[model samples]
Target: MFRGNKDEVFVRQALEQADYACGRWIASQRHFDVDPTSLLEPLAKAAVVTAVAIYVETARLSQLEVQRALAIETVAQARALIDRLHPLAFGGGWYGGRALR
Candidate 1:
């Protein structure tokens, strides 16, 4: 089993945040006022950004995943993307890796 410490806290937080974004997105979907396509970038960005947070936490991942998540051009979009992430990324001991068997 893998034990994640403070060094990896950011990744965990990212994953949790990603989760929250998904939930919120789902909630928004239930509404007639908002169009789902309007949220495409934010939701996708949240997932990707959170994935990068997970990569940062573990310092382990595929080049493609890293490229997709961490290699961002703007800090502002990254920050906004991070904000929309699910809070659980900071909680629960997820390593962006698989559950330890």
Candidate 2:
């Protein structure tokens, strides 16, 4: 139970960090009209994914039966918001030069 609580705290912190990154990306986009392919987008996405993964893993390790739909929805929403806002700004890849995968 103590470990579960600790993991929950960590997950919350990660999610907060992810939210901050998303806010930064949104500010950059709104103020500077930055491209979605910029570093901010990937950084925000990475943060968001890391947070969601942490939550999912914590729940698994804790033997807590949580619905994964929420996690999936969170990721989907973040991706859509990040990509939809700057549809025309996707000329370059995420890393700027070439695709990572």
Candidate 3:
């Protein structure tokens, strides 16, 4: 779970960085008055997988490996986030891609 203020700030920073990387607008501009939690749900899911993947890769450098729990959690989180994502999130010109319609 997020640790509170400091962590929440970091989370916002991370989301801003990701927006920059993806050529997307700032969450405040695109998402407007929407709660940050709605924006973060998908990001948290991706962050979990990325974190575990990096850990696994780094562990391989030392001949170690990730535990099964991490893999299970990743899959479950992915499913939950995917289910929550609207089709619009993946489609249209909104994301700098061609519109599905």
Candidate 4:
């Protein structure tokens, strides 16, 4: 889990939103044929949520340089953990690389 109160709140909000969207999307897709790969979508969204939480929390840092560095590092770590748990989650690409900038 991550540190910081605001960060936790942000992550919770993101996760709730992701859940809502995923539920809606899945329901909408029920009419169509299902594929095994479709199950990975939620995992990918979770990775993105983790990265955004890190970015949001790190931005509160006092120093600009430190904030930027920490954001990238934390996001990378989150992505790595997600990728390790579900290798197919990100499709072999780092998530949220552009969001940090």
RMSD, one per candidate, in order: 11.5, 13.8, 16.4, 13.4
Writing each residue's lDDT as its tens digit, candidate 3 over 1-101 gives: 75669976987687567745452332223332344334333444444444444444543322122232133333344444333332323343334643122
Deviation (Å) of 48 in candidate 1: 2.2
* Candidate 1 lDDT, 1-101, residue by residue in tens: 66759657976675566565565664343332335334344554555555565644554444555554555444444444444332323433333534211
TM-score quality measure for candidate 3:
0.26
Which is the winner by lDDT between candidate 3 and candidate 4? 4
Residues 8-49, model 4: lDDT tens digits: 698688667766467455434342234433333444444445
Candidate 1 displacement at residue 44 in angstroms: 2.6
Over 6-99, each residue of candidate 2 has an lDDT whose tens digit, in order, gives: 8779867855665645656533444324443433344444544453444446433221212222233333455554453222233355545321
Model 2 TM-score?
A: 0.26
Whole-model lDDT values for every prediction: 0.47, 0.43, 0.40, 0.42
TM-score against truth, every candidate:
0.27, 0.26, 0.26, 0.23
Best by TM-score: 1
**Each candidate structure's count of clashing pairs:** 15, 0, 0, 0
| Maximum-lDDT candidate | 1
Can you tell me which runs of candidate 2 are displaced by over 4 Å? 13-22, 25-41, 47-101
Query: lDDT: which is higher, 1 or 3?
Result: 1
